[model samples]
Target: MTADTSMTTVKVTTEARDRLAVLAAEKGQSIGAFISGVAERLPTAAELDERDERTRQALKKFGIALAISERAEGEALWAALDAGDDEALLKDPDA
Candidate 1:
């Protein structure tokens, strides 16, 4: 081992060994160089983003869900507006 670098021998599974060999060949890099490059440029686990999304989920089991809001049903006013009854709208504020 030198001050610049130290080599440590380690064991890997047959599948891992084969995959490393293929990757090294494809990238035109020796096995040692490929492994070293991977180790040097590897992204941090904290930097990796994981998204969890669910469709048509039921959150009832977890806890009670509060109602967002209750909108006033201004059905009559909407109906008058749809009919274009300007006179009726002015006559009755509710309508």
Candidate 2:
């Protein structure tokens, strides 16, 4: 009976449905509208923090860690590149 607007259906547990209904009522909007608005809005800092925690947990489960290191000569190389001193580039044309 409602108009279709390229929307998709998702199934949630009874508890989740109840919680969403309560949140929507608090915002004076339907559950569908509340979910749509959240999808369109930018994520908040709290949301980003939660996302980062979830990512860290998932990476830990897979025994993965991201790390960065610099070589001893990295600063000189970067300085040369910044100064546009192409002598090094000429010496190592292949590089």
Candidate 3:
């Protein structure tokens, strides 16, 4: 079978299993579906690193080329954007 069609088993403690069952019941999802959802929403180290790089690129594009180590300015910009200010990164990228 191809990797896409392969299946694997994971052994968990009874408590953990019961917890998963409860969560699945609450969501109206089968254990398989619930597990899949959990796995899909999780980000790997590589994904986070890539997102950081993308953030840097986006900042640079907007003329806010602060180093990655300097997260204060970027966090503020993100906060403004989160607060519904679309011009946060657009108005003064140099700021």
TM-score, every prediction: 0.42, 0.40, 0.60
List runs of model 2 lying over 4 Å from the truth: 1-4, 44-95
Deviation in angstroms for 58 in model 2? Answer: 32
Model 1: lDDT equals 0.61
Model 2 C-alpha lDDT per residue in residues 1-92, reported as the tens digit of each score: 24558877999999999999999999999999988877768677788667667776788789975322222244466778789976754554
Cα lDDT, all candidates: 0.61, 0.72, 0.82
lDDT of candidate 1 at residue 6, scale 0 to 100: 69
| Best-performing candidate as measured by lDDT | 3
Who wins the TM-score comparison? 3
Residue range with the least summed lDDT across 10 consecutive positions in model 2: 66-75
lDDT of 1 by residue, 1-95 (tens): 12567687769999998999999999999888899889767755543322111211234346644232311224456777789976655664434
| Deviating ranges (above 4 Å) for candidate 3 | 1-3, 70-95
What is the lDDT for 89 in model 2? 49
Ranking by TM-score: 3, 1, 2
Model 1, position 1, has a per-residue lDDT of 18
Off by over 4 Å in 1: 1-3, 46-95
lDDT of 3: 0.82
